[model samples]
Target: MPVDEAGAKAKGGRKRLIAIAVVAVGMLAGAGGVYWYTQRGSADHAGEKQAEAAAAEGEAEGGEGHGAADADPTASYIEVAPMMVNLRGGGAQAKFVKVRFIVVAAEGKTDAVKGRIPVILDALQPFLRELRPEDLNGSAAVFRIKEEMIRRSTAALGKGMVRDILIQDLIQQ
Candidate 1:
C-alpha cells in the first residue's frame, strides 16, 4: 500500500534531525583531539628545554675541572718546615686545618717575602692546625689562610718568605 503524504513528511523530518546530531558529535570529537595534540606538543618542548639546560651545566663544570688540572702543581717551592702548635692546652677544639705547603713563583708580591720561609712556616703550620671548629667553618677560610700566610711572611721573614706559600692541601688531619 502507498503511504500518505503526511507520513512521508514525518519520515523525512526524522532523517534530518538525525543528520544534524551526527554532525554535532563529529565536530566535538575533532575539537577535543586538536586540543590534546597542542597540549602534547607543548609538554614535549618543555622536556627538551630541561634536558638542554642540564647538559650545558654539566659541560661547564667539566671545563672548569680541566682548567684546574692543567695548572702547574709546582712552579715554585715552599715547605711547611715543621709544626709544633699546641692543640690540647686551650680546649678540645673540633676545627683544625692541616695544610701541606710549597713555594710557587711569585705573582705580584712573592719576591717581597721569599727569605723568611723557615720562620713563617714555623708560625703558620701550628697556628692553622690549632684553630677551633668555629674558625674553619666558613667558605672564606681559604682566603683567611692565604692572608695569614702573607702576613706571617712579612712579620717573621725579612720581606721574603720563599717565593709564595702554596697551600697544597687543607684537611682536618
Candidate 2:
C-alpha cells in the first residue's frame, strides 16, 4: 500500500498542537482558580484574626469579674444637657428638653471612643436645639434622640465602637 507521508505528518502535528493548546488553557484556568481561592482565604483569615483580637480584648476588660475596683464604675454615669427647642416661628413658645445619656465602648474596644464623645455631643447639641415640639408630635422624641445618639456614638467610635446609648433622664417641658 502506498502511504501519503506528507498528509500523515501534517495531521499528527495538528493533533499534537491542539492537545498542547488544550492542556495549556486548562493549566492557566486552574492557576487562576487557585490564585482566587488563595486571596479569598487570606481575606477570611484576616477577618478571623480581627475577631479573635476583639474577643480577647473583651475577655481582658473586667469580663472575668475579678474585682470591683478595676471595674468601670463610670459606666453608670450619663452626661446631660438641658436646652430649649425653638420652633421655626418667632412667636411660638419653645419647648424645653432635658437630655441625658451614657455611651459605652463596643466589645473589645478601648476608651478611645469616649474621647470622641465631644464630637458626638457637638453633632447632637445643634440637632437637639433645633428640635420642635411639632417634630415630636408623634410623641417619641426621646426615642429619636436615643437613636441619634447611638448613631453618632457609632460614628465617633469608627462604625462599631459604641455598644449602646442609655437614656438616663428625658424631661420635656
Candidate 3:
C-alpha cells in the first residue's frame, strides 16, 4: 500500500511538470510570432527607402541631359504671403489658422497668376475664415482645402491661369 501511494504521487508531479513545460513553449512561440510581425513591417519600409533612393539617382542622371529650353515652363512657382485668420467657431478661446503656400501657374501664365495674387487672397480669406476647428481634423480636410484654393484661384485669375497650390505651412493656434 505505501509503494502504490508513492507511485501515484510521482505520476501527478510528472503531469504538472509537463503542463508547465507546454505553457512555457506556447508563450515562447507567441513572442516569436510578435517579433516576426514587427520585423516584417520594418523590412517593407526599408525596401521602399531603397526604391526611392534608386529613383532619385535616375532623376539626377536624367536631369543632367536637359538644357534650359528643355525644361517645363509651367514648373515655376510663385510664393504667396502667409495669412492668419481667426476661425469661425471657438466659444471661449479664440482659434486662428496660419498658412503659407505657393501657386503653380499654367504654361505662359506665370505673370498673370502673379498679378492676381491680391484677388486670389480676396477670394480665399472669407472661405478660410468660415472654417471651424473640426473642419480641419483629418487628411481629407487637406485635400478639400487644396481643391477649394484651386477653385478660388481659378475664379480670381480666370480659366487655365492657375495649375495648383502647394501648401508650405499650415498651423493652428
Judging by lDDT against the true structure, name the best candidate: 3
| lDDT (C-alpha, whole model) for all candidates | 0.53, 0.57, 0.73
Query: Which candidate, 1 or 3, has the higher TM-score?
Result: 3
- Tell me the TM-score of model 1: 0.41
RMSD in Å for all candidates: 20.0, 19.4, 11.6
| Cα lDDT tens digits for candidate 3, 3-51 | 9999999999999999999999999999999899878956764554454
Judge candidate 2 at residue 53 and give its lDDT.
40
- Candidate 3 yields a Cα-based lDDT of 0.73
Which residues of candidate 3, in runs, are more than 4 Å off?
A: 1-73
| Global fold similarity of model 2 (TM-score) | 0.46
Model 2 scores a C-alpha lDDT of 0.57
**Mind sharing the TM-score for model 3?**
0.58
Worst 10-residue lDDT window, candidate 2: 60-69
Error of 2 at 109 (Å): 2.9
- C-alpha lDDT (0 to 100) for residue 1 of candidate 1: 25
- Best-to-worst order by lDDT is 3, 2, 1
| Candidate 1 per-residue lDDT over residues 4-80, each given as its tens digit | 88898899999999999999999999999999987885576455444434433332233324213125544344455
